[model samples]
Target: MNLQGIAAVVTGGGSGLGAATARELARRGAKVAVLDINAAAAQSVAEAIGGIACVCDITSPESVEAALARASAAHGAARVLMNVAGIGGAKRVVQRDGSAAPLEQFRRIVEVNLVGSYNVLRLAAAAMAKLDPLDDGERGVIVNTASAAAFDGQVGQAAYSASKGGVAAMTLPLARDLAQHGIRVLTIAPGLFLTPLLHELPEEVQRSLGESIPFPKRLGKPEEFAALAAHIAENAALNGEVIRIDGALRLPPR
Candidate 1:
């Protein structure tokens, strides 16, 4: 599937990995839609890439529907969907004081990370299924963002890890379910990256985190993640797999 002149939708496109992917897609000639909860941030990225900006609440169907409508109206039905919008927080099952963690906290993370991703993927794939095949019966591709914490969650990350784990667990089954429609599904589980939030930390803290990686001794770059996503879109054979974009970093249990 060539990206040239095709419609692509990226959630969380306001910043971090999604923004990087949107830029890369635009560079490859794809008509991009930048979706984010923050209207201003989304608009900024969209403007930079000459794409449409759509404000969306990933956890709400109505919001997502409206966002997609605007995207499709402007760029046609999306053939590439990237589910990148998510939230994370650290909380143990039991607090340090021995009180049980609030169930709402866990639910919130799952709602935004796992359920939200599935919502966008389903909607985008439905649109993709209607389009004519581009090459070798391939109609579209969906790339989801997971995290290495899904596999090796440290202490105080129960909610965050579980949410990400659900994303990873669903990858293969989603690919299998959508295979008949000529759509491919893949997940990228990234390790520590210097995202905006992390970058705001003290310099020494950032360096300490980067030094923990097994190789390259630094955080992964958003552009690097975007580059792999571009490759997945072009290489039709790569499907039903979760690629780890970590620098061989196996998170240790805290």
Candidate 2:
């Protein structure tokens, strides 16, 4: 997979790691499609990268199908699908009032992070299966986003961790399932990073969080994540694994 002149679709392409990925893939000569629920945000990133933007809701099959169709119509069948669209929430199993956590919160997180990812993946794999294999007999590659909390979630992160945990757990089986189609699947579990949400916090809070990392003593960068994703797309043998780019920061029980 040279990635040159091939089509790549990036979900959550509006900002953060997804935006960085769309730019990196485009820089490598891939025709990119920025798929996101935020129409304005997706359009902005797409325009900046000279790519098309398709408003998508990954949890809905119809929405994903339409977005994929639009992407295919614009850039041909996408061989690189990046499942990055996700939401995060933190809640304890039992609140301070001794009441149970809201089930809807957990459901929403799982629906968006885990089920949503699978929705796009299934549809993308179907399209990729129909394409002719490249020189190495590879038809496509998919990279899913997980979180460090999946391994060691802090307090109030039950919902978030479970959703990301599902992502990490499915990497191997999904890779094996798609192996017959010449499509590889992998997951990236990122630790603390400076996403838009984190950036909004006070400077001292940000600094404190960065200092938690063992070696780097800083938060991860979106570009670093995008770089890893691009490398994963090019490397033929790096399938069915969940790679972590967390700067050696394991979450402490809060």
Candidate 3:
């Protein structure tokens, strides 16, 4: 996958890792589609990259179908799919007062993170399967966003961890399933990165969090994530793998 003149789709391209990915793919000569739930954010990124903006909700089949159709309408079926849309949450099973945690919170996180990712991946892969193979019999590549919390779940991250864990666990099976179609699937479980989630904190708080990384003593950059995703698209042998982009940081149970 040279990425040159090929079509690519990036979910959650409104911000954070997804935005960076959309830009990177466009820079590599891919005709990129920026899909996001936020129309404004999607349009902003899309315009900056000279790509099309398709407002999308990854959790809905119809929504995803429409988005994929729109992307294809603008720039053929995408050979690259970046499943980077997700939500995060933190909650204990039992609150301090001993009340049970709201199940809705857990369900929402899993719905938007795990189910949403699968929804997008399935639809994208189906479209990719119909495309003619490129070099090495490769049709396309998909990169999913998981998290270090999937493995090193902190005390309050039950919902978030479970959702991300599902994403990580499904990598191999999905890759194997898509292999027949010459499509590859991979996941990236990033550690603490300077995503918008952490950007709202005070400067000292952010710095404190960054210092927790064993080395480098700083938060990971979104561009670093984008770089790895581009590499995965180019390296066909890297399928069915979940690469951790954490800076040697194993989150401690809070």
Candidate 4:
């Protein structure tokens, strides 16, 4: 797909990898929509990229539907969808307090990470399928965000890991399902990146996390993740795979 002038929707586009991806897509001539729970942050990024800002809470069906409709009305149906809205929670199934992590907490992680991704995917895919094919019948591409923890989760990451794991496991099936419409699906499993959460950590803790990477020995950059997403979007053959961006580091047990 050329991406030029095509409509693209990026969830969690307010910051981190999603924001970087939105900017990159905009630079590549795509009509981007910045979707985030934070309207202010979404508006900031959208204004910077000359794109639309749609406030959306991925965990809510009504919120997602309205946001998708708004974006589609503004830029037309999305031919590129990026699922990047997620939350990170760390707790063992049985916490040190001799109590298990609340079921609601785990459900919330799954809701925002897994079900949220699916909500956007289904909505975007439906819209994309209605569009005419471009560049050898390729109508669109959907990129999902997972984490390296999905594959190598350490202690105290049950909820986070499970959420990401669901994302990784769904990639192939989604691709297969969407292939008939010339739509591709892919997932990215990033290692330790300097997202807002990670950046807020104490300086020493951040340094320790960076040093844990076997190579590079530093946090991954948001731009790096965005670059890979750009490559995946442009390369039609690359589908149904979870590409890991970890710096050769397998996380240690917490």
Candidate 3, run of 10 with poorest lDDT: 85-94
lDDT of 2 by residue, 170-202 (tens): 999999999999999999999988999999999
* Candidate 4 segments whose C-alpha is farther than 4 A from its true place: none
Off by over 4 Å in 3: none
Residue-by-residue lDDT tens digits, candidate 1, 54-77: 999998989999999999999999
Question: Compared with the true structure, what per-residue lDDT tens digits does model 4 show for residues 1-254?
Answer: 78799899999999999999999999999999999999999999999999999999997889989998999899988889989989988777777788867999889998999999998899889888988998589999999999999988989888899999999999999999999999999999999999998888998998999999998999999999998998899998899999999999898887
- Give me the displacement of residue 227 in model 1, in angstroms: 0.6
Give a tens-digit lDDT track for model 3, residues 1-254: 79999999999999999999999999999999999999999999999999999999999999999999999999999999999999987888999999999999999999999999999999999999999998699999999999999999999899999999999999999999999999999999999999998999899999999999998799999999999999999888799999999999999987
Q: Look at candidate 3 and tell me the lDDT of residue 28.
A: 91
Off by over 4 Å in 1: none
Measured against the true structure, the TM-scores of the candidates, in listed sequence, are: 0.98, 0.99, 0.99, 0.97
* Model 3 steric clash pairs: none
TM-score of 1: 0.98
How high is the lDDT of residue 152 in model 2?
Answer: 97
